[model samples]
Target chain A: MRFKNVFSIIGPPMVGPSSSHTAGAVRIGRVARQLLGTIPNKAAIKLYGSFAETYQGHGTDLALAAGLLDYDTDDARIRHSLEDAWSSGMEISFSLGVGHVPHPNTARVALWAGERYAEIVGASIGGGNIMIHEMNGFDVQCTGEFPTLVLLHGDFPGVLSGITHVLSEDGVNIGYMDVDRKARNGEAMTVIEADTKITAATQLKIQQLPHMIKSSIIDLTLRS
Target chain B: MKYRFLHELAAAGQQQAKTISQIMLEEEIAESGQTEEHIFGQMADYYQIMKDAVNKGLTTNTQSKSGLTGGDAQRVQAFSANHEPSSGEPASTAMAYALAVSEVNASMGRIIATPTAGSCGIIPGVFVSAQERFGWSDEHMVRGLFCAGAIGYVIANNSFISGAEGGCQAEVGSAIGMAAGAMVELRGGTVDQAVHAVGLALKNSLGLICDPVGGLVEIPCIVRNGFGAVTALAAADMALAGVRSIIPSDEVINVMLEVGSAMPSKHRETAQGGLAQTPTGRKIMENLKKRK
Candidate 1:
């Protein structure tokens, strides 16, 4: 089921030495960038398991850096992404994690830009596919395979209904949805993977809803 | 709209009176909710990347960042141009092209991962070289990619395509089977022949381990891609010549999953056993560590 389309098997033109290590790393970084809604001025990246062991040999570091710069997977500039980051005044650091990881190719990336910040934990499962498991300390699952909506809102009654109403009005069917909160009636996060791309107008409508703090659409298909 | 197994795909192709590639294209359109023109355009772009990588690797003598591998593809191309190879022009040229794309991959150049980057070279090698030999247009090769995609989809869902999970059999073996099956279709063979080619190619690669020296995608990995292209050509010819696999393609894929699961971790891209632990491999690893 993961390999839904023919292009998933035969395509995804990418700059690579290894899809799982390099291209998948690029996608993880790209997803983090999209979540943050802009290139961060500072980033902290943590590599775990196999990624830490063979990151240099596989160009995982460079690919991750390039992805944070909003470069596509096929961008040849990945080879010199570190230099690019330095010249662009992007403060980035990489560290190896020593404990258990959910997957062999796990990475925890935290980004900060002015007053905005985001944290993501994701894994490059195989064949350039990724599963993002955590965002801002919330346990959620997103694959970046579809147009996804991530919303931060107050944990209160009618918030979920308000969001789904916007999507339904736009004719965007929700293929999957995950809702998580730190505590009852506190801040909460909603992750929605939609069957069709949500229009910018629909996203704005959700963003203006009561108790909605932030809304961002991670549309990976557009880059492809 | 979806066919999970080779038999199902073949039956769908037969019932609908379409080629496997056509069936795959239709399925992709339905599942992705994209227009046929858009999907075909994306695949066409990937094919162009494949051709570009082959040309770049063959033309340049670029070394990887680790300096462990470089220029072997050009050397092979020179050898093929100067002397008659025992394997004939088709196989030899395909081997050279395969080496080229793999070398490009090692250098972190742009390329399409047919299934995975470790086995990125096989489909381009077979398709580009065959295009040169048969005088086919890029459009024809794009359709062949759809055929390859169909086979890879089935293998990926049924077995595995990552070296860490299933060793090189799942990576290079899947590529070879995909290329063999696609080549059969491109050569105007029946859907039955294409399925047989998948079985024949995969049967030859059942227990192949994924022991890359120093865990980099160089050394044995690149050379294996070269050999894989030749095997794909031979398997396609065999299937086209009325040879049928006694074991069905779907059964072969299941067996690959079973064998890959049974394989030891050391032989599954861990760089612990096989050639990765050789004296020279250890020396290379040590040197790389010192540099870091």
Candidate 2:
């Protein structure tokens, strides 16, 4: 069955091992890392739902650790990734959350880097697919596939159109895009799913946009 | 040309070969780009991977045999001895190959969710048997796998291979088709026959459940791979020999998708149906779940 939003991009990719456990777990970790925005000085990952129950055997633990450390699925280092995460000063933990969701595989990883804190909640669809459902209490949907541009732009009219114009000028087609508002006159988050490569110039221009709050280009085209 | 099916099959074979080589290269098992020589080299690589896996398996078997003999020289000597004469051997036949596959799964293979660890045996069971009687080769066998991989790539691309969505059909059925098609290719059959063999393999196990006992890839899944391999070879051989199915390969794939959709959640590898229904199955699952 076809899925819209984050679920669509999450379904297919060339990844190592199983998709649901390995790929999904890695995506969740990657999201957590992105939310942290730096190599974590220290972090604690709590896996829930299916991830908590079968994390060890399914290699979900290693996957999360690898993502936090910025390792891709095909990284040969994944085999000994836990030690790597620990050596890099990342703290990890696991617990089953007391809740139910549509998908059995879900997780929450709370991260910290010297007081810079962020929370990432995500789900693993079957075959190693992952959807980042919520981030930092905001209902944000992002599939950890494709090269994504996430910008916290001004909560104002014409911001969306301007973003599209930039992409058009760059010859990048939009595969998917979504926006969420945190307030009436504060900041807004625009998650653009792109088919073409995001150049450095485009990233710099998006950051320099008037009233732009924060921006990051997340490139996920590297084979897992 | 009223030979639309034939032309399509030939085209499909070439396309299949290209895709399989691509995946192999992407997986870092082979290099990028190709000529006829490169394609053949990739085929050789595939052959060696299959052959080496089996060879590595022999080490464990030898160790186990040695342990059983407990260093008794006479016992070890007797065990190592080959007594049967080539003349006294039963007539080399396809049926013999098929039976041998069953024996391999039952006695040798560590099943990977209804797929034989020894991937080649299943396809060879039918392919080799038919080829012996009809004359085929290693090249045909490799090409069949390439085609099968193409079909598998599509399913894997479009659906799932974790036995979580689609079941054994996605794994063993794909393998069988590849094996059978290779057989057909070697025997000078048209590409339609190869694709049909894939369809035939998929059809035989459309809704075959993935009920690995205790969540281990052993027991019934192992034996099932043997059966799956033989079935694929047989399907490809029949298609090659000019036998046409009322249902086409594409239709069978659609059916597989439908059946997968209709299946109860319990049957989809939750360890809750078929063999998993028994008291013994429940106990095994419980024991596994209890482990950290």
Candidate 3:
């Protein structure tokens, strides 16, 4: 069922020695950048399990750096992403984590850009596929396969309805959704994967909803 | 919208009076909710990428970043041009092209992951070389890719396609099966034959381990792709000649899953055992670590 599209099996033209390490790492970084709404001035990446074991040989480091720089998976510039990051004033660092993780190919990326900061934990699940499992300390789940909206809001009544109402009003069909919170009446996160593209205008409308603390759209389809 | 197993796919193709390629295309359209033109166009673009990767690797002295693999594709091509290859022109050319794309991958050049990057070269190797020999148009190659995709889809969902999950057999073995099935279709074989080719190719690749030297995808990974393409070609030829697998294709795939799961963790891309633990492979790792 995961291999729904023929292209998922046949293609995804990429620069790679390994799809999970290279292309999937790029996607994880790209998602982090998108969540931050821009290329971060500083990024701290932690590779877990197999990603930690064979990252250098597979160019996982370069691919992650390139992703933070907004490079596509197939971009030839991925080979020189480290230099590019240094030249562009984007500080990036990597560390290997020795601990139990849900998946072997896991990476936790923390990004900082002036006053804005975001942390995302994701896993490269193979064949260039990824799943973002944690964001901003909230346990959420989403695959970057569709145009997704990740939102943080106060855990209050009507907050979820308010957001879903805006999306439904805009005629966006939700394909998959996950909601997680730390505690009752505390901070909460909602991740929405939509079948149709969520326009910038719709995102703005959702952002303006009451109790909305932060909102970011990670539309991977735009990468071409 | 999709067939979950090879038998199901074969049945659907037969019941619909369609080729496996057509059945796969229709399933894709249904699952993705995309128009036929849009999907076909995207596939055409992927085919171009595959061809480009093969061309770039064959024409250039591409070296991997680790310096572990490079220029073998060109060397093979040169040797083929100078002497009569024992494998014949088609097989030799396929081997060269497979090496080319895999070398390109190791060098961080653009290429399609037919199922996964470690096995990326097999489809393009067989497809491009066969295209050159048969003068098949890009459109025909695209259809062949759909056939390959169908086989890959089943294997990926049922068994595995990543070395970490199931060792090299899951990666390279699945690629060989996919390429063989697609070749059968491209050669105008029946759906049954195509499915049989998947079994034939996979049966030979059973128990293959994934132990890359120095943890890079350069050592056995690249050369395995070259040999995989040859196996795929032979499997297709056997299937077309009315040879069938005594064990069904689905059973073969299930056996692959069992075998791969029973394989040791060290042999599954960990670079800890098998060839990766040999003296030469250990030396390569030591050298790479010292350079770092």
Candidate 4:
């Protein structure tokens, strides 16, 4: 049941040398890009455990760069993503180690656009599958396995209800919900996994709620 | 979800009173909510991709970015064209296709990861070569793919499919088993025989490590794909010939899980042991670093 379709068993239709290191790395990078809502001018990638030991041979470095630049898993341009990033003036750097993360394949992808910054901690488990453990210091569980809507807001009573109310009003069936926060009345993240795409209008409506700072919709269901 | 066992596939076949392909088809339909025709079209598309990868690699002399893998597929095919290969046409063709796909992958080309990219070579190598050898229909090939996929599904759920998780045994080894099972089904063997083919294939691959020279999927990785394909054919033939595995497929899979867990981290695709530690392997790693 974890792998629901034949496609999961057969493919990802990817550019390859290795799936866990290449395609999975690209996906982690892509998810980070989508989370930032825009491509970052600067990115610092940190590979952990097995990823640290063999990033170059598997094109994990290039693949992650391609992903942060918004390239898909099957994009041929991935072979030259490093050169492309340099030409685009998108600053990128890589290092090894994500401090005690249990998974063998983990990446802490940090993206920045001047003052706007987001840190994504994710693990590319296997079979091109990934699990996002934390984002921007909030412990949220959102895998790009489904169409997900992630919202950043202040930790308060009305934030969660307001966001869900907006989504429920649109008749969006929430498959799962995770409300992760730092402390009481501090910053927070509400991650909602939905069956269908959440439109821009819906995102704007949710963002307009009090304490809602930002929102981004990650749709893995398209060519998903 | 309950179909995470090998016996479950046989049970699924028995419950529906159908072949392994039909059982897999029913499971796929129930899960994805797509029609049989739609699923078939998608599988056909994947087959096309696999075929295209082989075609592309066979035509090109381009080496991978690592410069370690290339030109071998063409060389193998040319050598087989004139010389009488000891393994005969089918094995040679399968090996050629296997190397072709691996070459394509090493060069960063688009290819289907039957279970994973590292092991992509084995399935296309065995299946398409068999089709060319025996004139298997597109529909028949599709059925074979489902049979392969069912075995992969069980292996993936029970253990893992990536080299990083369970070494090359999990990647190439699983692909070998998958191709064997698929071959049995395509050759009209019983479901029990298909499962037995899986066991017979994997039982030989128990301790294979994921030791790529310089951490690249070139050195032993590309070469292993060819042998893996042949092993699949051999396993399929054995099962079709009524050879039985002493251990069942279910127990064999559990052994894979245990061995993977017991395997040291360095041997599991970290490029720290086996061939990766050899003099040339270290040199290649250094050269790659300098180039970067």
Candidate 5:
């Protein structure tokens, strides 16, 4: 693997009850907010398997709430997330789902900001590391350990080429890309994972393209 | 049945009596200290002395602010009652909050950083319980500690302690297992029973998330240590009573591994899931960032 063993402790020490439940949840929530392109007006998250069974004990509920509100992992406000959520009038619920093949601590977060909507599914790999498994029914993957780009563009022959071209022109290097199809003629999802920065101008240009539904840039630089 | 339990338990307790200090020494081998063998020998000696202290009933039960007390009981009641820790009482209602400040400092000073600083309370909790309950010879308790060390080694090798990798299963889960196994040995349980106890304690908290608000390990992390300590004792007690788990230790370890792999990154320690996403959570982060 290009990354270190998922369990290796490479850097400074961490604060934890468990890295996945607390830190990973916080980052996932933050990523979900990024994918929604704004703080979620409301979010409904369902945790499958172990996450649902032990969410409260492990602080998963609080971490998810913190993530939706756009809190970073180290944000002290995370302690008060439940109270904040209750006061904010956000609807949050947890459910156990049947996803055996995916990671053990899988979670699906659906975010709504007025008219805008997005969903993300991700997993904690280990050692405060995470893998964003999918976004909006697309087979997307990113470590959330680096600065990443989650772009939703129209399905076209030249879409990938256009994205890479613009990125290359802007001095951004492509790390990885995944594409998922909803239909032959309907809207499709494209997730581009990159090692470089995705500027505001690039995001705007990409969204302006025909067939583009939404565009989001998620930065996971400090989260990993 | 009574004889069988006592025999099995005593045999298990004696299995690793001399090895606990050996393991602690080995854990510190790579650090900047004396030679590896020297450190190992020193740890072994310390283990023996500590064990002897227990045998002599010389434990200092100093009632350090970090010791488990009434607060632990209240937290257990709250968890069983499925009530959240009262966030309303920040500094006043609970004495442990004041103690938490000192506990963090003591952990930084006395205990070796095994996985995390926030989880420092577990080992001490185990030692204190052993001192109070059995008052066993230092050798016996030291062996018990060694047995716990073996369990920790297995967990470290098979899984991870990073919340990001496997959520809290790797951190608190593993810690609970270690404490339970250690307690089993001290209490004269067989190694198999020790393993079973460790597994049960771990399974109880499997998939627990590591969501520290604002990424600090203070809030839930501090309190969870007390719980892990008590649970470890409970697990050891169950094992001593011949309450075997349907699943073997190996199988339970496997389950933990699989469950951890399946956890989402957000659910780890990224502060992205659970409480990190709430409006108040966001505001807290924003406020902290602003302060920074």
Candidate 6:
């Protein structure tokens, strides 16, 4: 493993009653927004276990809603996210999810803006760090710890090769990669954790590749 | 060897005959691919943020929406300022500052989650109070943070730092231990003394549950930060006086993990038991829900 940045352990300045509940929820919502490609017109936040039990007190609800608007973790506006959502006409709802969740601190944010939609499932794994375990019903893994590219494509040969070729040509180093499919030769999602920023041109090039259905870039290069 | 475990960090410091802060700074430089000046500069920003949080918390009287908390930080500050604290000015001041930060966190004010938000108070509490007494330089606080971060990293990767996963022992417990070690380093104690301070501070926090009344970070959490700061001071003082811990630092961490694992789910951050289940606690929860 590459060196774990000491800053990862030291701090992430944020508004909080709880890091796992508030800060982590903000990151998940931010990723959901990124995947959606626009400020969400509507969002359905389903929380499980501890999140469901104590989200209100921890400000987890407000944090998630604020995050969908790309609010930073320390934003004071987070406290009024629900009201803001209402006033902004961003329809939002929260529900107690009683189903499979990998961790106790789990949230499934379903979001949409116009024609674009994204379903993001993430776990707040303590200390405000999070792992986006699932996206759009596809079992993929990403932490948003680094710049990441999530590509939806047809599961076939050359899809991964073609994407990596573009990244390689652009001088982007792949830190980690995972490809998940529903079945042997079906739709797939590929997650690439990038060591360097995936330039706008690089992302466009990857999206333009044959068999690429959708591509989303989640930038964690800058620690917010 | 990598700085993944407490033993590795200790061994690296021993082999190079460097202080814990020195080893940590070198490791940070290697991991971040940045210059030491940059890291120090970033630390300065964090220091300023911490100071800002303390100051904001001390002055803010705005109550949280939940109506359960706010204003205790100011009360503590007032008490310390108006009278002579038998524990002395420095420790009392630290407690006040720590309470202020924790109060800030409880009220959803911006704060640096040092390791985690639930335990955010102890670091600033100790550092600011120590600064009030000794007036250490900005560089010294940065070094102390490096030392503190190193200790927290070991525990976080090896065991857990989430209250929901390992209870308050992992949350506040880790913060207090980290603060104690950092206090030692800032005061010019050796690496071994810093480790000893961590051990002393951690041992007593073991088996502590994470039960906040009404599932809020107020109630016990804010006041507990004051005690945690005091504990760090005591441990640092003992280590500086050449006190030795019978249990090694790594073993103490293991002990804390064991205790957290043995605890029931209700005892964690679920808020289903402990003080959270008391009659008054239940009333508070009901009132909060009614307001919502």
> Sort by DockQ, best first: what order?
3, 1, 4, 6, 2, 5
lDDT of 4 by residue, B130-198 (tens): 998888898899888888988988898888788888889999999999999999999889888999999
Runs in model 2 lying further than 4 Å from the true structure = A1-17, A41-53, A97-104, A108-110, A115-143, A171-173, A180-187, A221-224, B1-146, B153-160, B170-191, B213-227, B272-292
Instruction: Name model 3 segments beyond 4 Å from true.
Output: none
Q: What lDDT would candidate 2 get against the real structure?
A: 0.55
Task: Residues A93-134, candidate 5: write the lDDT tens digits.
Answer: 766667563765678889987988889898854434567888
Q: After superposing candidate 5 on the true structure, give the runs of residues whose Cα lies further than 4 Å from its correct spot.
A: A2-15, A99-101, A222-224, B1-292
Compared with the true structure, all predictions reach lDDT values of 0.90, 0.55, 0.90, 0.86, 0.59, 0.86
Rank all candidate structures by their lDDT, best first, as comma-separated numbers: 3, 1, 4, 6, 5, 2
Ranking by TM-score: 3, 6, 1, 4, 2, 5
lDDT tens string, model 4, A68-125? 8888778889989999989988999898874689588999999998788888998876
Better of 5 and 6 by TM-score: 6
Which scores greater on DockQ, model 2 or model 5?
2
TM-score against native, each model: 0.95, 0.66, 0.96, 0.93, 0.49, 0.95
> What is the per-residue lDDT of model 1 for residues A44-158, given as tens digits with 9 covering 90 to 100?
9999867887788898999899889888888879989989988988999999997877876899999999999999999986778788999998999898888999999999999
How good is the docking of model 5, by CAPRI class? incorrect
Candidate 6 local lDDT, A1-224, one digit each (tens): 32156676777878878899999898899999888877888899899988998998898988898888788777888889888878988999999999778988999999988888899899998878898889999988888878899899998888899998998899988978999998777899999988777888999999999989999899844434
Candidate 6 runs further than 4 Å off: A1-3, A220-224
The sequence of per-residue lDDT tens digits that candidate 1 reaches over residues B1-292 is: 4788999988888887888999988888887788999989999999999999999989987598889998988988888889998888779999999999999999888889889999999999999999999999999999999999999999998998888778899999999999999999999999999999999999999999988888899979999999999999999999999999999999999999999999997887778888889999999999999998
At residue A11, candidate 2 shows an lDDT of 22
Give one digit per residue, the lDDT tens place, for model 2 in A1-224: 22221112112222233455566677678777876778886767766554554456446777788888777654556667889888877777766676665455678888888878878678765545567777666677777666788887778888888888888888888877888888987777888878667888988877777778777766654543
- Runs in model 4 deviating more than 4 A are A1-4, A154-171, A208-211, A221-224, B34-37, B290-292
Candidate number that wins on DockQ, 3 or 6: 3
Cα miss at B65, model 1 (Å)? 1.8
